[model samples]
Target: MGMRNHELVPLQLIAVIASLKHGGCHKVLRELVRYKLVAYDATARRKSSNNEGYRLTNLGYDYLALKALSSRDAIYSVGNQIGVGKESDVYIVANENDEQMILKLHRLGRTCFRQLKNKREYLNHRQAS
Candidate 1:
């Protein structure tokens, strides 16, 4: 999909892009929202409007990345998360031949509050003064 300024896309537009019936497209979107893969804004639907909106969550993007990797034979099984750092999580994965690999997912625009405070303790001291 091409990048758009709006995060929430209209249901009708999505239906037209996917070439699916409006009802069918809504059903698929409902399922994704139920799984927390998509965010739905029913508040946007006015009394006279039938259009709803949806946007993919971070988990949804991660799911797409995982699907692409598996389809390309880069990952077969997702093993346990071996490490968690300030910016990312490292996972041990395996390929078709059982070769071990590392998968690191970086958190964009996210951070652990506790870790952030600890890492920037000096800044906190300056503010108090």
Candidate 2:
């Protein structure tokens, strides 16, 4: 979908694209909606059994832009998706030096916070090793 488009997207599609579990995607989406970063529409509630849909608000787009700019390594461009895992998606990214790098977006803690916390701590410990 276009960045400016406000089309209502199904939760399943978003979950698949982000490599996040359905429950986790829903939780995060609720938070985003609460923060006004995403809009959840239930207009089809009467017509359809699955009534929920989501669309990114302008704030969400701005947040993404800010995150990109604040990164230590300047990202020149984002390329195609390289891989998709259970909890993340890997994409090809080009840095200021034109070096190709893999960018992984992790979707942790959709179902259980304990598991996410454990995994995060393990990663932090490994990084500090």
Candidate 3:
């Protein structure tokens, strides 16, 4: 059988934790929890407070696999960094392969309360206007 794309988010989350920073799993998982991209056993025994590790949902795996293949080329540019949500920094990455895609790197080890407050303020201003 061919490789699937659905496991990307969870696998990438794991990869980011394991490779980028060893202690980033909780931070990464917090950001991805809302994406509905992981299938995990809720009943799995917890080894500690940080025992919950994610397994890739079919969609999550597929996407990460694709990204691993595509992003192998030299980076073309870090075009622009747009703040998509509280937990992500979105960048436009163009590569030597002549492909351009949005790369959303999760902001681990930060609180998003400030972003939430700003969003609320913006909404309140719009309502008052």
Candidate 4:
């Protein structure tokens, strides 16, 4: 996703980009807002139309950056976004070796938990065998 300085993203757009259903997106956004991790502007306007939108708070940005840094592989730099889906975004990144790699960041939530759980179980079972 392109960085917009203090940009507010609509709920619908967030749902589409995060690959989340409306209900799930609402739930997650509510929680984030409650925690002060995301800022919500219900009176925000664009093109003279009022709309509700969300933006990451400083805390949110810092949390994401820390998470990325804690990955197993040392990341040199995060480059452009390559793809986006309902639940994640794929980005081009440089590793410690300076080799380009694709980084997929998942935006899992209540709606996607079951799917991820099943996949994890399957992988674990396969590995055990």
> TM-score for every candidate vs. truth?
0.70, 0.46, 0.33, 0.50
lDDT for each residue of candidate 4 in 16-122, tens digit (9 for 90 to 100): 88999999999998999999989987774447877668878655864677476757566777889899788767788888888988777766432575564444433
The lDDT, on a scale of 0 to 1, for candidate 2 is 0.68
Task: Name the better of 1 and 2 by lDDT.
Answer: 1
Looking at model 2, report the run of 10 residues with the lowest lDDT sum. 120-129
What are the per-residue Cα lDDT tens digits for candidate 3 across 1-129? 011222123444566546756447656665666686555544434366333345555446445644674677545556776666755567777877768888776543236654534444323333222
Model 3 TM-score relative to the real fold: 0.33
Instruction: List residue ranges in candidate 4 displaced over 4 A.
Output: 2-6, 44-47, 73-129
Off by over 4 Å in 1: 1-4, 42-52, 111-129
Worst 10 residues of 3 by lDDT: 1-10
lDDT of 4 at 64: 78
Q: Write the per-residue lDDT of candidate 2 for residues 1-129, one digit (tens) a residue.
A: 322232467788788878899999988988998999988786764454655578766557645864775485567778898897776667887888889877776665545655654555333333222
Could you say which candidate leads in lDDT?
A: 1
C-alpha-based local distance difference test score of model 3:
0.52
